[model samples]
Target: MSQPMIDPFGREVSYLRVSVTDRCDFRCVYCMAEDMTFLPKREVLTLEELDRLCSAFVDKGVRKLRLTGGEPLVRKNIMSLIRNLSRHLDSGKLEELTITTNGSQLARFADELAECGVRRLNVSMDTMDAAKFKTITRWGDLGKVMDGLRAATEAGLSIKINMVALKGVNEHEIVPMMRWCHDNGYDLTLIETMPLGEIDEDRTDQYLPLSLVRARIAEDFTLTDIPYKTGGPARYVEVKETGGRLGFITPMTHNFCESCNRVRVTCTGMLYMCLGQDDSADLRAALRASESNDLLYDAIDEAIGRKPKGHDFIIDRRTRQPAVSRHMSVTGG
Candidate 1:
């Protein structure tokens, strides 16, 4: 008698993460091989279609929206997209619109983004050492990324630096890097590598658990657990007098899927209820067919209905099967 509710696992679907594009400029080795084949441009959905889908989800009671990408900044006319979405949804209801980027292209666009109401930024920087950064990212210019960070902070964006803890690679820089981030008024997070792609080299040398990372940092400076859970997986810790804090996301060894309130929609328009799950519903077809708002609403409802209780990340890790075939860049990390 009633419309079937989607993603009602305990009766809620509060977050929507939309990836504007599957293409990125960076050649991070772990994200993707430098020579990896990318998704063809024709396969990508139009920006109009993306906005329609986002609006339909909002109509269906989804509130939070995060724009992700192979790098969302690379998407042309991104300000128009954000402005359009901001127009359709009312203020508090839309809640927040944030993006996570590699920071190479952000320096050029940070001001425009600030003008468009993008107030938060999460940047990925694995190491401060220029040589090591170049090695890990395969010639990704480190100076450009730093410039992006500086520009974002200057734009008054809430900044968080996301670092992947690769043992022998960048783990040694953990304390100094976090200290740097704090000194500069930025939040720092240490994320463990997930079993997403191939592992020819054991980069797990710095595979120290979150507890260990916290302990090491705590030894140097006293850490006070920042009161509330600040969304996502990271556990926030603050220094007594410092304005910034450090976050630790150890999803590999610790699972936060149960509380995961996020869903990913790739640039091509496939709605993935859970990032670790392989299957997703393609909504681009319906979007291009007709501009029916109800149809769009139902499509979002259907996608949410199919959202699983959680993902099989822990299980897949044990089996040694790749947890995700498309890699983080393609699927929007």
Candidate 2:
């Protein structure tokens, strides 16, 4: 039997989110500031180092692996990394290997991804309107994203569209987006805007609660609670008469920290214990200083031991504030 990566809270940490690069093609207002500085190439972990680090975790019993980035596909030769990481799936060490992309570059790599053993994808698409999409993502071309979505669907990859609901921005498009997803045979997940990093928009004005979203959704369709677990924090529900399902990820209104079973490693190899907190361990330094895998394991174990019971997001009546200070783009959110 393998040793399980159990945190101090007694939750089995079986999922790993790896940020391959901090470089992104689009600048979303809610994720980071427009004038962003990315990490130098020399500072980020090499592919071999990432493979070794991930192998260490798999040896300790992590079964689910997710590759993320400012835009994962933008990382040069990402297909090579996908092929290398896919070995765990074939060996039965990993139950799933997935990636979360901005969908800006998926059309170019959809077929190669499927051939490389990547079967699941979470694509971020906040709005369907071309002008609104361009507004939300500073330089995004919605037509390109649509082409990518179509190609991925045709490639036989399970597709899920993640929409971040901003109060005055794209909240009105909730029902429309859901309808589109239902019509296209795709799953939709609505996420509340989190206060991470120095975003261009005011966090107070943009933060939309999932409760309000659920109410808005219920007005048009009856939602039946569905027993579905996507290995993440989203709560699933089936939209009546639609073959597709809807998910709500409420980080501000309701924190799912108690049942959290994942740990994130940034492009620079900083291990974040919680998404909404600043607690982290520098695995890059350990990997660079030592050749033994035991050193890397000890650092991960210590970080998990210090994981907080819950996030510090406070929501009093209608006011809300996030306790985290890191940028979502850099942390692989």
Candidate 3:
């Protein structure tokens, strides 16, 4: 009914990534500290509230919706939110409803997700080695994730593996991981380590630029640029040898903010226009102020108007502090 959200740079904001919960089962070395404090349940928006907020975005011309989190599947009764949002897909108002997860609980939720009209999932898996997986994800079991992946495929859910290119951590696993993904009929996407939140280890030791990874892949495999897009920032290429698609998300080496058409909302109802910036609008306050959406719509428009032309992200070697104080999980990983 209203005009579609258009940022100041003329980019239409059609993709919305919402963080259902900030609580994750695993504390990854790059994502969170071993011992972390999570938000109180009272502060988080209820499942019904999330559904209403998401439907509001769909009405405002958001065709693609991605549910992200500390691990979206870890949230209790998350399937209800998925099923409720599926109505948008049924009514032809939304194009897709996808989830980005760590694959810990996919084994239990994959079939339900597919049944609820979720066609695709982005699973974050850095290494196939069990030891390395344990090291990366402090509390994760490689066996469980592997089982989850198998179950996801069996459920008819298209999966894309999102591997963060860690310098010395998983750099050696790139070729192996790519091959594994292709062998299992899954697309592989390598993402550069973003400078967000303070972790146990220094990020400088883990920052692996995708440009370097691309050159390394070229030595073993022929990569041809492709025009494939998944409503995200990843630039894709086709691997001639593997006959699979490889995507590169270079936030540090090369930023892709010029074409950013997405915004993120935390589970607490904070709308973030940019991931690397701290500017945001508290939509929860607006939502609670009234039962009507008149105030919510106005808050969304004001947030879009304040969206920056591009985010300014940097990984300083001298200081270990992150560009943004909020953790990646807090911003809807």
Off by over 4 Å in 2: 315-322
User: How many clashing pairs in candidate 1?
Assistant: 6
In terms of TM-score, the best-performing candidate is: 3
Candidate 3 residue-wise lDDT, 90-194, digit = tens: 999999999999999999999999999999999999999999999999999999999999999999999999999888889999999999999999999999888
**TM-score to true structure, per model:** 0.90, 0.96, 0.99
In candidate 2, what are the lDDT values of residues 208-295, reduced to their tens digit? 8999889877887899989898899999999986768999999888787878999999999999988878989999988988988878
Q: Compute the lDDT for candidate 2.
A: 0.88
Clashing residue pairs for model 1: 6-304, 6-305, 7-304, 7-305, 167-205, 167-206
Please give the lDDT score at residue 311 for candidate 3: 78
| After superposition, candidate 1 runs with Cα above 4 Å error | 1-8, 88-92, 198-208, 241-243, 314-319
The number of the candidate with the highest lDDT is: 3
Two-way lDDT contest, 1 vs 2, winner = 2
**Cα lDDT of all candidates, in order?**
0.76, 0.88, 0.93
Q: What is the per-residue lDDT of model 1 for residues 163-186, given as tens digits with 9 covering 90 to 100?
A: 988766777898788778889988
- Sorted by lDDT (best first), the order is 3, 2, 1
